[model samples]
Each structure stands twice: as C-alpha cells, then as structure tokens.
Target: MISGLLTGLSLIIAIGAQNAYVLKIGLHKKYVFPVCTICFLGDFLLIWCGVFGIGAIIQKFPIFLDTFRYGGAAFLFVYGLLSLKNFFKSSGSLVAGNTVSLPSLSKVLLTCLGFTFLNPHVYLDTMILLGSIASAYGEPGKYFFSMGACLGSFLWFYSLGYG
Candidate 1:
C-alpha cells in the first residue's frame, strides 16, 4: 500500500494537461466539485483497469489506439486555437475573483471530459505503467496497489480543486 501510494504520487505529481485544466478551473472557482470528481473517478477507473490487466487487452487493439491518438490530437489543436484566440482577446487572467463569464455546465463538463480522456499520456501512466508495476505484486497486492493509486488520485484532485 505504501509503495503504491508513493508510486501513484510520483506519477501524478507532475503537471500535465489534465492537471493544468483542473487547476485553471479551480482557480476560477467554477464547477470545481464536478470537475474534481470527474478527474478522480477517471483516474480510479483507469488505475483499476490497469491493475486488472486490461492494458494487455487494449494493447491488442492497435487501430483503436491510433484512432484515439489522432482524435485527441485534433481536439487538442482546436482547443489550443480557441485558447489562443481568447488570450488575444484579453478575456481573463488566471487570477481569482475575475468577473469573466462562467462557461455553461455542459460545456465545462465536456471540456473536462476532453481533458481527461483525450490525453493519451493518461492511459500510458495510469494503465500501462502503473498496471505493469501492480502486476509484480500479484492478486491481493495488486488490489491494494490500485486502491492506493486511487487514493492518491483523489487526494491530488481534491487538493488541486479546493485548495
């Protein structure tokens, strides 16, 4: 459990797309709970699937991986364009208490989903890497490892969201 927790933290502590978006939303204090929940659940599901050896099944489907890779890249490109436009328009800063309009719930949720699922690195870290590590522990230890990973995810997201 301790090793799992440490491993999970080590993997997730780094800043990435998902963490950046979460921190942005959190700083703005909009949909923080739901956004954080989505992140936590997403991590939990991926880590659990990895620990259970689903990564092997996913590896068998190269076409599926390729499709997701291209699709995610396209989405990210568009999102970047929009963000760049917004930046040029002087929409808002990352500072708290800005009066910028909050995005609609559906839009926010969709964006959060995009950030969560569209990042291929999420799968690589949580599913492939973590899963491979957990496999070394066998059945019961794998479960504990997954639980620790999940806990680490929850702590990180909640802290990033609310702190």
Candidate 2:
C-alpha cells in the first residue's frame, strides 16, 4: 500500500495538460466541483480497469489503439489551432474579464472531457504501466494498489481544483 501510494503520487504529481486545465478552471472558480469530480472519477475508472487486466486486452487489439491514436491526434491538432487563435485574439493580459470572455459551462465541460479522454498518455500511464506494476503484487495487492492510486488521483485533482 505504501509503495502504491508513493508510486501513484509520483506518477500523477506531474503538471500536464489535464492538470493545467484543472488549475485554470479552479483559479477561475468555474465548474470546479464538477470538473474535479470528473477528473477523479475518470482516473478511478481507468486505474480500476487497469488493475483488472484490461490493459492486456487492449494490448491484444492493436487496431483499437491505433484508431484512438489517430483520432486523438486530430482532435489535439484542432484544439491547438483553436487555442492559438484565442491567444492571438486576446490582449495577452492576466486579467480575466477585460477582453476575454469566459467560456460557457457546456463548452468548458466538453473541453475538459476532451483533455481527459483524448490524451493517449493518460491511458498508457494509468492503464498499461500502472496496471502492470500493480499486477506484480498479486490479486489483493492489486486492489490495494488501485485504491491507493485512486486516492492519489482524488487528492491531486481536489488539490489542484480547490487549492
């Protein structure tokens, strides 16, 4: 359990796009509760799936992974372009409401989902890698590891969202 807790913390502590988006929404105090809940639940689901050996099934089907990879790439490209356009249109100020309009809750939620689901790294890290590691501990240990990982995810997202 301690090992799992430490490993989970180490893995999720990194500041990635998902973390950044959570922090931004948190700072703005918009949809923080829902966003954080989504992130935590998403991580929990993925980690549990991993612990149950879904990673092996996914590995067996390379085509499924390929499809998602290409789709994720396209989605990321379009999102990047949109972000670039927004950046250019803005006056480049930290002030929230001066020249930039906050996005609608639905838009924000969709974007949050995109950031969460479209990133292949999330699956690789949480599912494949973490799952493999948890497997080394046997059945009961895997559950403990998964719980620790889930706790780590909840703690991290809540901290980022509400801190």
Candidate 3:
C-alpha cells in the first residue's frame, strides 16, 4: 500500500498540463471545487478500472490504448494551437488576462473534463503504470494498493486545488 501511495505520488507530481491548470485556476480562485472533483474522480475511476480488470484487458489488446493515444494527440494538437493563439492575442500580462470575462460553468466543467480525459498520459499513468504495479501485489494486496493509490490521488488533487 505504501508502495502504491508513493508510486502514485511520484507519477502525479511531475507537473503535467492537468497539474498546471489546476494550480492556475486554484490561484485564480475560480471553479476550484469542480475542477478538483473532476480530476480526482478521473483518477479514481481510472485507477479502479486498472486495478480491477481493465488494465489486464488493455494489456491483452493494446488497440484501445492506441486509439486513445492517437485521438488524444489530435485533440491536444488543436488545443495547443488554440492556446498559442490566445497567448499571442493577449497582452501577456496578468492584469490583461484577468480582464477577460468569466467563462461559463459548463465551459469550466468541460475544460476540466478535457484535461482529465483528453490526455493519453493520464491513461498510461493511472491504468497502465499504476495498474501494472498493483498487479505485483496479487489479489487482496492489489486492493489495498489500489486504495492507497486512490488516496494518494485524492490528496494530491485536493491539495493542489486548495493550497
């Protein structure tokens, strides 16, 4: 379980787009609750799926992963171009950034969901990586490991959100 906790933390602490976005919104004090909840839930569900059975199934047939990877790549490429355009259009100052109107709740929710699901690395981390590790623990041990990992994820996302 400790191994699972540490491994989960190690994987998540590597400052990905999700983490950076979480920190960005957190610092801005906008939609922090929904953002954190969605992210943790995303991790929770994926880790559970991986720990229980989806991980092995995915291992057996990697095509699903490949599909997600390719689709996510395309999505990310478009998202990156949009972000670049936004950056160029802005004055590149915090004050100017703040002048923009509040985005809708639905938009915030969807964006959070996108950050969770649109990134292929997330699947690899929660499903393939952590799932592979939990397998080493065997039945009952794997459950404990899964719980530990979930707890770690919960801690990390909430901390980043509230801190």
Relative to the true structure, how large is the alpha-carbon lDDT of every model?
Answer: 0.87, 0.82, 0.85
Per-residue lDDT over 1-163 for candidate 3, one digit per residue giving the tens place of the 0 to 100 score:
8888888999998887789778877766788888999999999999988887797687789899898899888878887898789889987543323656548879888878888998999998998888878988997999899888988999999999888
Cα error of candidate 3 at position 20, Å = 1.7
The best candidate in terms of lDDT: 1
Q: Which stretches of candidate 3 lie over 4 Å from their true place?
A: 59-61, 93-97
Query: What lDDT does model 1 reach?
Result: 0.87
What residue pairs are clashing in model 2? none
lDDT of 2 by residue, 1-163 (tens): 7777788889888988789889878777778999998888888888888888886688799887777678778888887798789789876754333445558988888888887878877788788888889999997888898888888898999998888
lDDT of 1 by residue, 1-163 (tens): 8788889999998987788888888888989999999999998998988888787687797776787688888888898898899899995687777777678989988899998888878888898899999999997898898888888999999999888
Any idea what lDDT model 2 has? Answer: 0.82
TM-scores for candidates 1 onward, in order: 0.93, 0.90, 0.90
The full ranking of all candidates by lDDT, starting with the best, is 1, 3, 2
lDDT of 1 at 51: 83
Q: Give per-model CA RMSD.
A: 1.3, 1.9, 2.1
Candidate 3 displacement at residue 29 in angstroms? 0.8
